[model samples]
Every structure is written in structure tokens, then in C-alpha cells.
Target: MNVMEIRNTLGASVLCAVMFIGITALPATLAADDDAPARETATAEPPDPRLVSRGKRLYVFCRACHATEEVKGSKIGPNLAGILNRPAASLEDSLYSDALRQQDFVWDEEKLDTWLLRPATLVPGTSMAFVGLPQEANRTAIIAYLKTL
Candidate 1:
């Protein structure tokens, strides 16, 4: 496919995700499903290629604050290189909110899902201003893409 075709396909895919997923910014406390609980694994498995592709597309939205590259450095949020097991508020360059700095847990899949569902709710006064990804599929896909980085 040529450039125009690629753009059209990407546009359609984004439209579909937004429309079908019912992606909304609801309060995490309200939308979080305690039962669906993200499972914790000792070692993370490679993400499905298809899911990673979908997640890379979804990550366009997150590029505003978060950076997947180390050389790129921190933007509005911290650089996410090897963030899967990183501690919260540990980045040296970025200024973190008191809410986030107080946290003592590593970023495992379960924690990531919980945090991405609603960042503000997870760390009440976080400096990062993102509302959050409410769709479970979206969260899974994005998390998958993050793993690749």
C-alpha cells in the first residue's frame, strides 16, 4: 500500500477502536473491575505480535507525556525504558508529584493495568495529567507495546 492508503487504514483503525471500545474517561474507582484482576507473572512473556502492533498504534495518544525511548528523555512524564519492573517516582530528571513519590511498588502487569485505568485515582495528585485508558483491551494492547520498549 502507498502512503495515502496507509493513512486511510490507520485512520479507520483508530476510528474503530474509539467507536467500538467505548473509550471513555470515567473515574477509575467506578470503572475498575476488581474481578477481572490482572494476573501477576514471575516472568513476562513476549506480547502477541498483533496486540503489539495494535498497541503501537494506540500509543500515539500517550506520546504527549510518556516517552518509550531513553535518548528522547522525559517529556511531561518519565521515560518508560524498562518500566515493567521500575519503581514509581524513581526517575532522577523528572519532578514527581508527592502522591506518586510516596508509592513503593514496582510496575508489574497488574499494577500497570490498575494504574493505567486511572492515573489520578492510583496516585491522587500525580503531575502527569492523562485521564487514563478505560478499555481493558486497550490497556492490554498498550501494555503489550510498552513491553517491547
Candidate 2:
């Protein structure tokens, strides 16, 4: 082929390759926006402020044993700062009762509610000796407060 023809063909091939790459990358760029729908649906309901406030007051009891900080060895109980999203008894250094350690549950709202209502009944042989808040409203408030931490 003539030099000019060969050069033209090479340039065209490079342009096509670039265009193909750009097209493929478009989907990845768009994928991030897809999560917006999930987030919107997940966030439709706002948490109750009253419950959260009351729970904050109740959390005074928890502050004695647990802390909310991510730092290690901060308190007598496990650092509860991020307890909402974490699995039960999953804290690193805190010594847990065999019963609590063996439990496979995560600290979701329902589970926390039951646990707050009756700690020993929820998990038999647990080392957390404190009896739960007797009132359902108090327990619910505590759970709400814990979620905010």
C-alpha cells in the first residue's frame, strides 16, 4: 500500500479503538447514579425525633459500660458508638460471655428491641448482668438512641 493509504488506515483504526473504549466506559459512569433509587427508597421514612431524644437520655446507662468511639479499650463495655450496623458481640477486645459470643444475630432494630426488653432471656448465660428497662417505651427509646450513635 502507498504510505499515505497506510497512514490513513492506521489513524482510522486508532480512532475506532478509542471510540469503542469510550462507549464501554459510559456504562460504568452511569452505574453510580443507579444507586440513587435504592437510596431514595431506603430513606423515604425519617426516624422519630422524640424517640431518638428519649433514647439519648436512656443511653446514659449504657455510657457506663460502652462507648461510641471507634478507638479500642475505651470503656468497660464494648464501644457502642457504631453498634447499629455491627453484628452482636463482634467487638474486638471486649470480653464477652460464651453465650453472647456464640450468638449469630446482628444488632438490627428488632433484635435490639428484644434484647433491651430482656437481656438474659434474649441470650441465655450472657454476662451483661443488668436487667433490661421494664417499660416498652423506654426500651424502644433506647434502641432509637443507639441507632443515632
Candidate 3:
């Protein structure tokens, strides 16, 4: 082969080698991207049954002060029997805090969770002297139990 032809062949081989390396390396690059820790999957899991049971057990602590029975004017705190769906300050004959009575809010899971986390923060100038449940799991359990009420 001529000198020019030989040189051209060598250049072509070098180019081919570089391309092969690049192509082979692409999969590993892609795999690294794929293998990166997966993003936390957003899920709405049903409330744990054990949590609900535990909440029910813990609720006995509250029962002395707050009656779960629907019969109104029967406890230190308003009867919480049907509190889940009720309006925030709609309890009749129950002296709710001025702050709570002024605010228009419905008691729901989300609101309950926040309230349970910090009652004073959730409703400023509230009369609920009991400090809120701090642990998320316990709060969730208590909320589940409250819903059953």
C-alpha cells in the first residue's frame, strides 16, 4: 500500500477505536444515572390499623376530661362524639375559645393533624390547656381514633 493510503487507514482505525470506547462507556453513564437513589414515591397509605387501636387505647386518658358521647354539656371539653365532621366552634353550650369561635374552620384529618401537633399554634388564643401530642405516629393514631368517634 502507498504511504498515504497506510496513514489514512491508521487514522480511520483510531477514529473507530475512539467511537467504540465512547459507545461502550455510554451504558455505564446511563446506568449510573438510573441507579441513583430513586426519588421518594409519594403515596397515600391508609391509616395503620395498629395505630388506630393504639389511639383508641390512649384515648382513655382523654376520656375523663372529654366525653365521647353525643350528649352535650357532659364533660370538661365538649363531647367529641361526632366531632370529625363538625364545624370547629359549633359545639352548643360549650364555651369555645374566642379565637376558635372567630375562625371559620372545619375539623378534618389535615387540620386535626396540625392541631394535634400544636394546638396553640393551630388556633391562636385557644382555651385548650392540654399540650398537643408531639409524635406524628401518635398524633395520627389519635386522629384515627377521633375519626371513629
Residue-by-residue lDDT tens digits, candidate 1, 20-128:
6564534454446542345334455657999999999999878888888899889888899888889888999887888899999999889899888998877788777
lDDT per residue (tens digit) for residues 5-114 in model 2: 99999999999999999999999888978977899888836779998998888888787887776765656677887788688899778888889999898888888888
Q: What is the number of residue pairs that collide in model 3? A: 0
TM-scores for candidates 1 onward, in order: 0.68, 0.68, 0.64
Better of 1 and 3 by TM-score: 1
Which candidate, 2 or 3, would have the higher lDDT against the true structure?
2
The lDDT for every candidate, in the order shown, is 0.84, 0.83, 0.82
Q: Using lDDT as the measure, which candidate wins?
A: 1
Error of 2 at 95 (Å): 0.7
lDDT of 1: 0.84
| Candidate 3 lDDT by residue in tens digits, 24-44 | 999999997876655323443
Q: Which stretches of candidate 1 lie over 4 Å from their true place?
A: 1-44
Question: Any residue pairs clashing in model 3, and if so which?
Answer: none
Off by over 4 Å in 3: 1-48
